[model samples]
Target: MEQDTLDLAHISLRPFQLSDADDVMVWATDERVTKFCSWEPYTSKHAAVDFILNITTKFLWCRAICIGDRAIGSVSVQSYSGDDKARAKAAEIGYILGSKYWGKGIATKVVKQVVEMAFVDLPDLVRLEALVDVENVGSQRVLEKAGFQREGILRKFLFLKGKSRDMVMFSVLSDEIGA
Candidate 1:
């Protein structure tokens, strides 16, 4: 199907299930989808199972991006837990989509839903942010279209994929929504 004709209304987010390992592999094995992600492309279904069984349970908020109940990707919000008072009010958002689903506007729709849902679901959260690799223009556009403000770059802030990368910080404050 054509990108423009793809009905984004079909997109939805739900908790990851152990049964999603096969679907998780759809994007988990695609380097194109993991290029800007911190983790490398998964090489086995066991890794996907481990992610679903162990990793997904650790996030403050994590969900599978589904289309009519089929997992295509994931989105999550991670909070700085413990006694860090300064960081307690803030959390970071992250997401990934299968390479086959790119350019379909599925991500932007999912992101917008997550943002609205996150603020409500996590009431203590006053700020939700995302850091995008400078070279990942597509993701940057996704965040921008989802209403996040582009903050300045953090030069050499993160060392990922064997190199120090400059990252663009994007954020949406709770007060900024429905304002």
Candidate 2:
């Protein structure tokens, strides 16, 4: 499936462009930003841009979250997760914003919009999950605020920041996501 650029009346969601690399690198590659994430800090701008483009190209739906015009970060909902792939009716939501934009409620708001898009725009999708690091309390709150219920913990589900880490799973089904 091809990636579709989604729009939210005020905050537009589009594919990542090469120009976003410099600014994205400044924040996304910081140790503080990737501290609890499942990946290491990128050393160069090309790495960041290529990473975004590579993932965005494969997913059916991915968004470069934008505020006004600047691409502030990314929000992606893949067609399915490992176990959910057999269900053929679920998607997993993941996102990241630069550190400067943290605590602004922007991530929560954008995530809410993505939830709405999944339930309203996609007819076949039944649910969406947010896989957040167990230690990322702030992000867990964001998922909760966005209406995703805590499903459970994924034990040693991902190797991030040099070691295996657990993840708290949150999910919102189609029927539960209000339009």
Candidate 3:
């Protein structure tokens, strides 16, 4: 609903807009950001912007992470409806940041705000889960800093870069809020 920029002092999270497509292109296509991410390198600026515009209107939860006025990363959630558990007011989250910005706590801060927003925006949203590639230790740490717990290792649970990769299932339940 509200993709307006969110300011939490050190970092800000905003909606991914058509205008941000150009800024997004700088990192979205980089191997460091796309390797473990859901999508692959964008072949062109137009293609990148097209994707950003589409993501803006396609889902209930999506955002562009910004530092100052520049787009540095992105985070989003996809709804699951096939199963009772999947559709019980829950969704899976994913994210990536440019390698140039790595080792900073930007991702952690953005994730925390997004998780809080998810719970507030959707009252029944009892849980938010993230499937992190097993080798992505930095990503795992981001989830933990955001208050998500690693439930288990999902063996070959995801396909990445044309191969089956193990993933760590991390989640945060409603009852665990502020715990």
* CA lDDT scores, all candidates in order: 0.93, 0.79, 0.81
lDDT of 1 by residue, 74-179 (tens): 9999998678888999999999999888888999999999999999988888999999999999999999999999998999999998999999999999999898
* Number of clashing residue pairs, candidate 2: 0
Candidate 3 local lDDT, 1-179, one digit each (tens): 11344344646788877778788888877987788876788879987778786765666688888877677888887777556664767788888787777777778888888888888888878878999999999999999999999899999887877899999999999888877
Ranking by TM-score: 1, 3, 2
lDDT of 3: 0.81
- Candidate 1 stretches greater than 4 Å from native: 1-4
Best by lDDT: 1
TM-scores, all candidates, are 0.96, 0.85, 0.88
Which candidate number would show the highest TM-score if scored against the true structure?
A: 1
Error of 1 at 72 (Å): 0.4
Q: lDDT score, residue 2, model 1?
A: 40
Error of 2 at 10 (Å): 5.9
